[model samples]
Target: MTKIGKKATLLAASALCLTGTNAVAEDAQTQAELDALRARVEALETNRAGPANGDFRIGNTTLDVYGYVKADFFYDFEFDQGDTAFVNVIGEPSAATDGTFGATIRQSRIGLRTSTPSGIGEIGGQLELDLFASNGTAELRLRHANITIGDRWLIGQYWTNFQPLDTYPTSVEFNGPVGIAFARVPQVRYTANLGSNTVFSTSIEENVSGSNSDDPVLTAAAEYNNGTYIARASALYGNAQTIDGATEVDQWGVTLSGSIRPWAGGLFQVNYIHGQALGPYLIGLGDAIVGGEANDVDGYTVEFRQDLSDKWNVGIAYGREDYDLATSTGTLAFTELETIHVNAFYKATDNLTLSAEYIYGERNDVNSGQDFDGNRIQVAAQLNF
Candidate 1:
């Protein structure tokens, strides 16, 4: 056997020997043997678990790793940046059937979760990572790590209370709706069960903006479920922003979301969020458009979903985001950017799923910020194990 393999076998034999002698060995021998056996077991466990690869059980918490893979096709229409509203545009554009297609890994993340023993309070947590093409590289899209204490207290990074669970739709592209919480920063939270399918949660977390400041974020939410329907409302406040010469003002937002299962296999979902800026950079500017004033930014989104059958589903999503530019050279706030996405999915079997989607987006300030309109049609198959 290899050297490492032989060592492992020897350690296992020693552990067996010590355990076997404990029944008749003296007290000193028993204690010494037990210590050696525990040390050997721990060493082996560490080697087996490896780094970043974990399947560990500590106390009542168990941990595992999991993730998903995805690919897509994309295209762009009205892909121009210069003046185009009055006559012939300054740039050439292409449509969906013009052979514009590409693939993306999107996100392939791994995470862990654990549950409390039966009849006791429960706790769990997870983390995910993804690849972003905009910066020509992979990035840490979802860095979440959290823990629960006695079902009432939680500490870690998770989804903000302001975002609802139903906001995440099943899509092939891996992109989510705007004005939604894809993930949250580290936080301390409290949860109370109000009985009969009702839960109330409040949290204090660092602002998601990776900036250098003392401002913190606060969130509070309540959720209710009554057989066929689930509804949630939440509020958030924070003074966080960009660090590279960009000053974001204090901000507050509100979200309301709900889901309903009207029939045996049909589902309905709705979500809304509104935010206001609270600093000099955000004063006097329209909330839906940019360049009107300082710190002016606001956005909203809506989505509808239908499950036609066990293997097919369709959805439409729309979102609008407006920002106030720091200078007049920047594009108009309202016409800065807008996006719409439509998608569908079909499951071929228990393990294979196929999806197709179309994405349309427009940017008002193409010269200053590379704003343009584009379209994408994507189809991919995924296997689950």
Candidate 2:
């Protein structure tokens, strides 16, 4: 056997008996032996678990494979909202139903991560994909592909810097709430960590909104996290063009978000956003630009979570977005959208989970002078690897 292997075997044999008559010496020796045994067990798990536990090494680099296969079954009680509880569809009249049942595995995703030592620092990258393509087909969609230089620089496609990912609410649904800002874009980002509690990041990202924008968007954010508490602020600015490419408009946005854990197993999170011509970044809530001008919009999300037991946790989240659009004599558009989600997650096994959620969504049509709402019940089963 290899020298290291023999040493491990010998250590295991010597530490098999951890008790002795002498109190102090026995305590010290037993503690040392336990530490050695723990390290050996960790090494064994790292090597034996392979990709299952996302630990392994190849050559000079470490590679981790992680993701889960999630299948969701949902029943919509007012409108057929399909896989996602799209609140925008709630106010629409067509396809209205008393009940509609659907099942989808499109939320399932897989990722490969690599880290290696370099001259400057540790270089790492991630390539992740999911089966939730916009076309409704179960095609592979790129989630993130990024490379990190040291700890401060990131280059590639990833979450936009304007997104306060640290304080974002969690839900069983893919896109949790309506008022939250959500988008992934290609960008080059620079991050600065001040002391140990504060961080700042800035990026220039591609515009992927419905309103075409040839110019890149500039985004910046700052955050402070101290164990159980977090606070963040983010902003973005850019220029957009009409679909016909005839009109040009200015785009800008800002968001403030934070989270706090008061009790041992309880957490509260909230965020507020106000912006113009930023519908694309706000979960397609309202028009980014209309008639040569950017529409004004604001949104907020409030959430609370508590762990009931070691294997179960529950949460409730509420989100709402409002739009300020020109009210014409006969024009029609959405003025407000809101959603509420209450969910419970149960850990069935080390690698398996079960979850259920109830969602209520509402849409207010200003010009049409109508209000519509819908309810959804969803249950999901996920297997992690």
Candidate 3:
């Protein structure tokens, strides 16, 4: 209990406390180094699996290669005209399979894209092609050769950035369009990103009219998109020629589209397009109005899809188009045509899928009126790298 004894005890206690604090500090430094080492290893592993480089680079140079090859076997039943035309065009065994079955490549495509940073902005190019023909001849499908001066300018032949993704429903047999897309053209586009989730874009491409060397088709669009929902409005205008010997200029229309996911993996989508087909702009029209050939096409589509899981998927879609024909005596209006399709898919594996689809269509034109009730059950195997 002496004063000297108390001072000695306090000094010993202070030295022990200092030693403990130094040990804790050393442990903290070691933990920080471990964390940094783990992060670096993860970055290297990710880069090894993906592109040689990571998602981005300091100079803003990036590249991606993506594509899939698919083949399927299908059999059509309920021999009808509406459906027969679609199947026969794709080299199907006519309305009657004739007890013979065959397989075809369903749009096996490959694409490459790369972008490099420029002083002003970024310049990029993309090329997509299909190589399924018997001779192994590849055909160019998507080609976007252009520069994006900031986010405001893009000159290329890529998507117009118009219609919503839902416009292209899930079809096992990918013949594409099937008279669904009123206008899908090539053009020079200007896109402005208002925010992270909002964008406005417009394009001008070669028109059917306005002289053999006139400006391209004109299109403008605005869209707001989040992870779950996308809403868009777009317009298309161009010169079109008439069915007869006359030519009228300046034909255009507007479109609205949106998509929503209601459940874990379910989606509902709809698109409305109303436009005029004047002069040359109606070149893509498929309605035969007898005496009325130059007619405006207007239509809409509704599509829905549900993915039960990675193995199962189902979808349904309906589309209708009305053509207002230009007749000699007067205007002849007809229902034109309508189509409904349902499809289901079962994934046999990550590289294989089995699909079945049913499509029904009706046309007001007698020749087109042949009830097209077609059913296709196909098994397809795909490889992706």
Candidate 4:
């Protein structure tokens, strides 16, 4: 073996090593270029498919459409004015004594929601509609049209601030317990989150109908919610006006509502309201001011709901409204109204439900000293998407 032989062997080995390193670098560069090309193709495909899928994106905003289809069949043991009972108006002296059966899809609803990124925060808006029309025909009616700016301010028509939405019981009826504060009106609302479990909100809303006044209804509410227990308190102040613009009455109301989960899948809710001239704020049972005098009213609702299993649940509720018209010179159509509801719901699938309810109501006329009782059975099927 000679020095020249060793040197030649070392040079040949180094040349082979350099050639292998260059080949490896070339292969890595080729793979990087392929990945870049694949990503560009995917971007192009996504841009082309967005519009065809009905989910077109605008800037940084996304829009979604959602709703449910619901059908209700009902039978009444006593004749009422319509398919659904007018519990407050059932005890008139001219009431009929015939049973009725009917069906309605007025509770079916549709909605659109949008979210957009802004410099201040995320801006969100929702428009919702249902088939509950004003003229007894099933026409689309606006249920909610509102915009939420950032996380604190909301403007447009939404649930009234005095209403305790969390306290509402599950029911098969389109309208839940009658004594619960329920109303949707145009409002300017502000919400503040106090830590993780509490919230405070206030709003000014439209109060009376055709009242030629500048003052609006004022409301404030506070709520505390942990995973299992919830509590809420709200207050309302508004004005009542007459049709002829002849008289106006000042009205105020306070509501205390709460719900407790005693055990897994069991909930108990109670709502109590006492007010002068609360008729307009309630479920439109009567006028807040009759004959230029404000009516003092008290209403309460108690509901117990139990979930027997993942797919089955039952609820029982009782509600009452009492009017103090003993000293009023006006003719009172109803002085006391009571209602009971027992309902069960079964989830056929993740997006479909079947429910049945038995509803019984009694109304008393203070002026006529007459009482009328009505009973109804309702069955409903709903599909949500």
TM-score to native of every candidate shown: 0.67, 0.85, 0.68, 0.83
Q: How many backbone clashes does every candidate have?
A: 15, 0, 10, 0
Model 2 residue 348 CA deviation in Å: 1.3
Q: Which regions of candidate 1 deviate over 4 angstroms?
A: 1-61, 77-100, 116-120, 123-125, 131-134, 138-142, 210-212, 241-248, 278-298, 322-336, 365-372
The model with the greatest TM-score is 2
Residue-level error in angstroms, candidate 1, position 196:
1.7
Better of 2 and 4 by TM-score: 2
How many pairs in model 1 have backbone atoms within 3 A of each other, for residues 3 or more apart or on separate chains, i.e. clashes?
15
Residue 76 lDDT, candidate 4, scale 0-100: 77
Which regions of candidate 2 deviate over 4 angstroms?
Answer: 1-54, 326-332
Task: Give the Å shift of residue 180 in candidate 2.
Answer: 1.3
The numbered model that scores best in lDDT is 2
**Model with the higher TM-score, candidate 2 or 3:** 2
lDDT tens per residue, model 2, 1-385: 4333444566676666534445466778777767779798557444542343335566678777789999999999998877888777775667489789999999999999988889988899999999999868888999999999899999999998988888788788888988878988999999999778999999999987675988999999999999799999999999778888888888898999989999999999999999888787886457777777788898999999999999999999999988787322223367788899999999999889999999999877676688888999999999997
Whichever of 3 and 4 has more lDDT, that candidate is: 4
- Per-residue lDDT tens digits of candidate 3, residues 1-385? 3332333345455544655566666877655655565565444343332235323332456655667777766554443232122422222124444333546663678776667778877666666666534343444444344445566776655555544553455676553223344233456788888898998888886553322324456778888889698788888765554346355445666778888898899999887767665322221244323242334666677889999888999998877666666221112223444666788888887766677766655444333333333444445566653
Runs off by more than 4 Å, candidate 4: 1-56, 93-95, 208-214, 326-332
Superposing all C-alpha atoms, what RMSD in Å does each candidate have to the true structure?
A: 10.9, 11.4, 16.7, 16.4
Against the hidden true structure, what lDDT does model 1 obtain?
0.57
Candidate 4: TM-score? 0.83
State each model's CA lDDT, in order. 0.57, 0.84, 0.56, 0.78
